[model samples]
Target: MLDDRQTRTEKLAGEIADAILEGTLEPGSRLDEHMLAGRYGTSRTPVREALRQLATTGLIELRPRRGAIVAKVTSEQLEMLFIAMGELEATCARLSAMSMTPIERRRLGAHYDQMGEMVAQDDVPAYTAANTALHAMFYAGAHNPVLSEMTAGLRRRLAPFRRAQFRAPGRLARSHAEHGAVVRAVLAGDAASAHAAMLHHVSLVEDAFEQLAGAPAGTAPEAARMKAG
Candidate 1:
């Protein structure tokens, strides 16, 4: 039951995020839990959870009296978030290279290999899931609880955008290749290489999002323009 609820919440969150990013739901649009529940044929509980998920991404604001309001995530803000995410991930990768136990490294390698199979099968959802899991391993391998916590927080903030990145053409394969670089560096215990590779991979992730959104890297989204008007 718990897993089902979480699945529903994540699915609804993804759908709502799609609407927002596609300009179907412009900035300032009201997201009434009751209406959303009806619209999506779900209970208010899931609707609320979905909205809360979106709130973490800065794609919507949950206000005291206003309930939920779609918010304009400016290009500048997006860029800054990406920049921070890249740095955090890079640091984590570097630390993981230096600190991951041999057993942990073996598990990480096996996990990455499974992702390769997902890519071969063109299983976007599976690849996305595995990709997330692989990153979590890197964070855990860092052995710095504070750094790991901070990186996880930023990752949640960018979750929506990062998930959308997989929808881009050839992104799954490209992402896997990028991971290969980082994984190889980490496996070799080359901290500097791991840092550079992970940072480069994240930069490409931002690029992938821009390409899919039809927006230049770090520019205001159409929803922002709609709000401005």
Candidate 2:
């Protein structure tokens, strides 16, 4: 029951995050728990939990006496977050290139192959979920528990922005191509190349999000509806 409740909270958090990213919930807008519970058709319990979780992500701000409001982030702040995240991810790729077991490398390869099918089908949601899995594998293959924990935490915070990039036209194929570079370098044990490729890939991700954020209001298609991290 606890696990199920946790899942519901996480799901609600993702939905609310998506609305913020898509401009449905503008920055600095109040997030009333009661209203949100009604909007998402859940009780106040999960709605409250979801708001608390999103607060950690800097997506929403919680006040003492007041309720929550969407946190207003500047472009520079967003860039800095992506910079930190990209650097950590690059380091993980570098270490994995040097240390991952042969079997682990093969598994990464197989996972990449599966993602290719997702791209071919133009299945944005599947591709995004697989993208998160691929990064998780890279983090685990690095074999540093502390690094993995920190990286994954930041990733959860960046989930809404990172996943929103795929909604851009042709971004799925481009992202796959970028991952191809990182995968090849990791499989071949090229630490330098893997690091460089992963860094470059994340930089592009930041750019994609920026472009998506600037689009006209209400132009967004229905979000693929998957959790980012």
Candidate 3:
């Protein structure tokens, strides 16, 4: 069915995105559709669709004749993206604090607790999924469709870089603690506090990525340095 093919393409795109984030697929490296199709045990059609999808996320660059390559972002561009994302998310958090219903607040808290468990178990993938859900919940709680759509678009564009930060050692715990501040502020209906907390959390995420930027993706030398200390 058409839906199944779409699902498969999405799955392939996610796998390629992960590879790019982890440095297995280095930025600027050409992605051959034939090779990818062979690797994923599929035809070129799904591979092409997957590449097209990634291109929209700013993770893949499609050339007229050169095929697809991982998109390379300059440090300045990354900084701008993070700054924009932080501001947008902070606004959402503030609005959520002011607008979220009691049930929404409770559900957000429950999701935060589940993320903590994922962190404790060292389940990075699950934690990442939960983290994505938590942010979506914040957007939903804000009760602003336009703001939510804009934030979601930016988040998608920066998804790979943002996800890569979790590879830093102790990042999961730190992120959870940061989320706690946001959750507490939101639950208390302190919009200013929620805004501040969310902004701080996003800044820390940028810091985490900066710390890892120098090393090969999977190695995370900053993590090792912290552990050695």
Candidate 4:
């Protein structure tokens, strides 16, 4: 069925994205469709679709003659992307604090609780799915369609890196704690606090990713200071 094919394509895309984030597929490495198809035990159609989808996330580049290659994301580019994503998410959190109804807030809280359970069980994949849902709830709670769309777009672009952060030791617990801060602030209708909490949470995510990637540790402290302030 068409739905099955789509699901397979998405699964393949996520696998490829994970490989890139884990450094198994280094930046600038060529991705041969036929090779991937053989490796994944799938047809070339799904492989091609998966690569095209990855291209949309800026994780891979599909060239006319050269096929697909991993996109090189420089440190500066990563920093800028995180900054933009953080600000946008913070803004959404602030708006959500001001706008989310009681029922919506409760739903978000319930989702967070589920994420907590996932974390306690050390279920990274489940936690990641719950984390994504929690964020989607925040976006939806903002009640601003345009803002939600923009945030969703940025989130997609950062998906691989954000998912990679979970691989860091103790990151799940820390991430859950950060989410608690945001949840409490939102439930209390404290816009400023919600914004700060989200901003700090996003910054910490960037730091976790950097640590995983063996990058230099310079921006994390500043982000921590912001969280403290």
Residues 40-156, model 1: lDDT tens digits: 899999999999998988999999988999998877888889999999999999999999999999999999999999999999988888988999999999999999999999998
Q: Which window of ten consecutive residues has the lowest lDDT sum in model 4? A: 219-228
lDDT of 3 by residue, 1-229 (tens): 9999988987898888877765677777899988998888999999999999889778789998998988775666667788999999999999999999999999999999989899989999899889999999889999999999999989988876778788788999999999999999999999999999999999998888777665644543222223223
Per-prediction TM-score: 0.93, 0.92, 0.88, 0.91
TM-score of 3: 0.88
Each model's Cα RMSD: 3.2, 4.5, 4.1, 5.1
Off by over 4 Å in 1: 215-229
Q: What root-mean-square deviation over C-alphas does model 1 reach?
A: 3.2
lDDT: worst 10-residue window of model 3:
220-229
- Candidate 4 steric clashes: 0
lDDT of prediction 2 = 0.87
lDDT values for all models: 0.89, 0.87, 0.86, 0.87
lDDT of 2 by residue, 1-229 (tens): 9999998998898899888887688777899988999999989999999999999888889998878988876666677789999999999999999999999999999999999999999998789889999999999989999999999999998887898898888899999999999999999999999999999999999877767765765533222121110
lDDT-better candidate, 2 vs 3: 2
lDDT of 2 at 139: 97
Candidate 4 residue lDDT tens string, 1-229 = 9999888998899898877765567778899988999988999999999999889778889898999998876666678889999999999999999999999998998888888889989999889888998999999999999999999999988887888788889999999999999999999999999999999999999888877666333322222223223
Which one wins by lDDT: 1 or 2? 1
